[model samples]
Target: MSRHLRLALVQASAQSFEDFAQGLRSLMKSPNAAELVIYPELHLCSLGAETMSEREYYTAYAEPLDGPRGMALAGLARELGIWLIPGTVLERGADGAVHNTAVVYNPQGELVADYRKIFTWRPYEPMCPGRRFVVFDMPGTGRVGLSICYDAWYPEVTRHLAWMGAELVVNLVQTSTSGRAQEIPLNQANAIVNQIWVASVNGAAPTAQGHSLLVDPEGGIRVAAGMEDTTLLGVIDFDRVAATRKFGTSGDSWPWDQFRADDSPLELPLYNGHIDPATWRPAISPETRNDLRPAGPVVFCRPAGENGPQ
Candidate 1:
């Protein structure tokens, strides 16, 4: 059987929670509705940083993982019988720090995975940075990794996710500045270097520049949406990810397969560490791919001396 996933990327504008929910309902009503639907970052938060203070915005929207908003989103996924990634939510962590967290719900309404934004757009973004990388399996379909808006700029984020067996990296974005021009190319580059599918869903007009796109494993733009509220629908074949890694990107480059079993670790002065050649290749394989299913909350790694989330 073909491991194909029918998905939809919703390039939506900033809107109230009620409006967004209604729009999702409308989307499911269509006969061509997708089996998996994803929205842009903070698509449900409707953040108004210009009008209110960061604390006020948090006070207004931040909630725990089991909060009402999260439950409602899960309910929608269960009702629609589709995998749902409603983008990042303002999660009020138990440690008292609010995080820009991306969440995923399976068809059964289970909150399978949630990843905090490790690279929180720096000085501008007030949310605390997440420490770990996250990826979840979609049973027989594929394993997917999660990344937020600023995470794409850091190659380490996508590299680690791909290493952890992610065939597709769903990067939820919401960029309302000139930075989006750079983000588009970064998405393709991430896909090219990692040899994984990239679905970058950005918020539409008023909230963002809205050039949401999907790039194949070979770094080809399969589909892209302009600055408008539209849906980019496509079928992702996980087999292609395996084929790309087996053969070569454009049938010429084999970045992951270049490592040898006896190669020594390469030093890195920046992180004061070294890349272990023993584990250099991606962990995914036909025998171990099914093992990528969620196994509690796993934190891939953190900087030396850095503690886990506070």
Candidate 2:
């Protein structure tokens, strides 16, 4: 197959957890077609200047790993017969802690993988990190992995997934064009180093400056949109991913380590272990990397004795 699988990246502004799920179901009926559909990070809520209590309204929409929304997504996956990568959200536990989580559902309506956000940002404290990475098989194609928005910035996360036989890496992003332009390159490079397809979908319009992009393992931009409020549809060749992984004439050929995924069985229990939410972090750095870049806006910090708005 040569770049035949269609992909859809939804970039609309986020709503509540309930509305978000409903919205996802609605997108499936969109005029565009995709074998795989990806929602942006925090696909459940929008960012506002509001305080934590107000933000809690959004997080309250959070659920456990085995909650109703999870089942609903699984049903949607089954109904559409498409692989879906939902973004991170606040998953509350019985211990009164919340976690930033990413859940994947297969066409069969089963929970293929659920990855807790390893690297979270502010307002996402007391969440936990998933100890390991997860990869699953695509019906007629190769395997794929998932990551949250912040997780995209971390090299190890991408490296881990790439090493684990992932032909495709889907990153759900909820980024703001506040102070950085690192979004595209960071996700694209991850694909290059690992030789796989990388898909990143971010929010659009009043919520963000849209820049959703799809990149091939060779660092090629399959499709991209820079306009605000724009959404994009593209195709990726799953077969090429396998061919690219092969090591030419040398026995030491393929750069990918097949052993990385030898034991990553999706049925294994989540490593939620002794790890505490208060210590969890997003898979990537939430801070914008353009603090010193003259092309972007400058970030001014409050001093020890600022009296303007303290």
Candidate 3:
């Protein structure tokens, strides 16, 4: 059996929710329809700074788990006979808080998982933060991890999912043109450090950077999209993930094992939890490793004897 699984990354525009559905449908028309398709964060809504003041606009877009957009994405998965992650949408929580949630659908058109985004960057976006990360089983692929936009910024989120035995991390993002340069490299770095495959999908340019990228366990870009509305296809070889983890960057047997042996650096009780820190014991003889290095920018001299930004 082939260990390679095909995936489709839909670089959609910030049109209406219905328009996003149509874009996905058009992408799946090809004979190469993948076993899995992913979309960007806030795929169903606009992320322009002006939208923040329009409370009624969000009120109209926010829907329950079984809303119209959800139904459309679920139906598409069933019609295409593929698994789907319909990006992050505005969801109205039972507690009256609005959540930025990523919904997953199985081939059977059933909602398998609904992951609320945990790391919401305040001032950038206004939404309730999710408390935990979610990992689910993908039939052909191994365990899959799901995160949205800002969540990928924090390494702890990916590390937690990696420790939970996730083989793939799918990040749904919505970034501006200026942010893509930084976010793309950050995503690649996370995949390499975790020794797992990563698939990042984002909306098109103007509103988003639209540089959707798929990175292998070794931090190789398998497929990437430009700044436009289009669908990108890529394949992931499960064997590569297994091989990379077994023989990590420096021939180390699973890097996470040796690196994560001590979680003392993460003060759980003090950071988020309400527990008293005085009861906790400090880590003894912690290993110190410096991975930082200085990097110089590439400068291109123009024909006119002028330098350009790297």
Winning candidate number (lDDT): 1
For each candidate, give its TM-score against the true structure.
Answer: 0.91, 0.72, 0.79
Predict model 1's lDDT versus the native.
0.85
Model number with the top TM-score: 1
Tens-digit lDDT string for candidate 2 (229-302)? 55578877765554454432123444433333233333324544432222211121112122312231222322
Residue-wise C-alpha lDDT for candidate 1, range 1-310, written one tens digit per residue: 5789999999988777788778888988875489889999998887575698887898888999998999899898898898999988999999889999999999999999999999998788888899988888788677888999899999999998888778899999999999999999999999999999999999999778999999999999999988998998989988888778666788798898675667888999999998876667675634233333223222232321122111
Cα error, candidate 3, residue 256 (Å): 2.3
Clashing pairs in 3: none
lDDT of 3 by residue, 221-282 (tens): 88888899888888877656656654565566455434232334443564675322222211
For candidate 3, the TM-score is 0.79
The candidates, ranked best first by lDDT, are: 1, 3, 2
Q: Where is model 2 poorest over a 10-residue stretch in terms of lDDT?
A: 301-310
lDDT score of model 2? 0.64
